[model samples]
Target: MSERRSISSGSVFEERIGYARAVVDGDRVHVSGTTGYDYATMSIADDVVAQCAQAIRNVEAALAEAGCTLADVVRVRYLLPDRADFEPCWPTLRAAFGEVRPAATMLVCGLAEPAMRFEIEVDARRR
Candidate 1:
């Protein structure tokens, strides 16, 4: 059987919601949907572009803990409350994912909190 482990980023939501930031099962890493909120400060930027950047950083942190990098990511999902906000985030998204070119999807939907303008989730394989 493959070994299974979970990683946390010390976010209040993790404890309240009872979920890990990411779960590592053998070489495969499944990162939870991460928002712009900085776990350390519990703060989120109002701007979607800034939120996108921060969300990317949060996802990267989880990937790192799972012994993987952005290059290892094979799939990604972007969630936004507004469809129009997606295009403005293109440059930032491309900067992080342009090289890796992982299979991706974007959904326009309501988030847990109204303040959350963007969220990101990823799946990666440890090399």
Candidate 2:
């Protein structure tokens, strides 16, 4: 059997909701749906583009803790309440995943917090 390890970003939500920011099991790393809030400040930006960029940074942090980077990501999922926000965020997302071109999906759905304009989740394989 393979070993499993959990990583945390020290988000209060993780403690209340009982979840890790990411988990590493064998060669695979699964990052939880991460919102745009700067975990250190527990504050989020109002602009969707800014939120998108912050969300990627948050995901990258988790990926790094899992011994991988965005380039190792094989899948990505984006969640937003408003579909129109997706296009506005494309450039930021492209900048991160453009080279990797990981299998991707975007969903229009409500998030836990109304302030959360964007959320990102990813899966990566450790090289």
State residue 65's C-alpha deviation in candidate 1, in Å: 0.7
Instruction: Give the per-residue lDDT digits (tens) of candidate 2, residues 52-95.
Output: 99999999999998889999999999999999999999999999
TM-score of 1: 0.98
Note the Cα lDDT for every prediction shown.
Answer: 0.95, 0.95
Question: Each candidate's TM vs. the true structure?
Answer: 0.98, 0.98
How many residue pairs clash per model? 0, 0
What does the lDDT come to for candidate 2?
Answer: 0.95
Cα RMSD of all models vs. native, in order, equals 0.6, 0.6
lDDT over C-alpha atoms for residue 78 of model 1: 94
Clashes of 2: 0
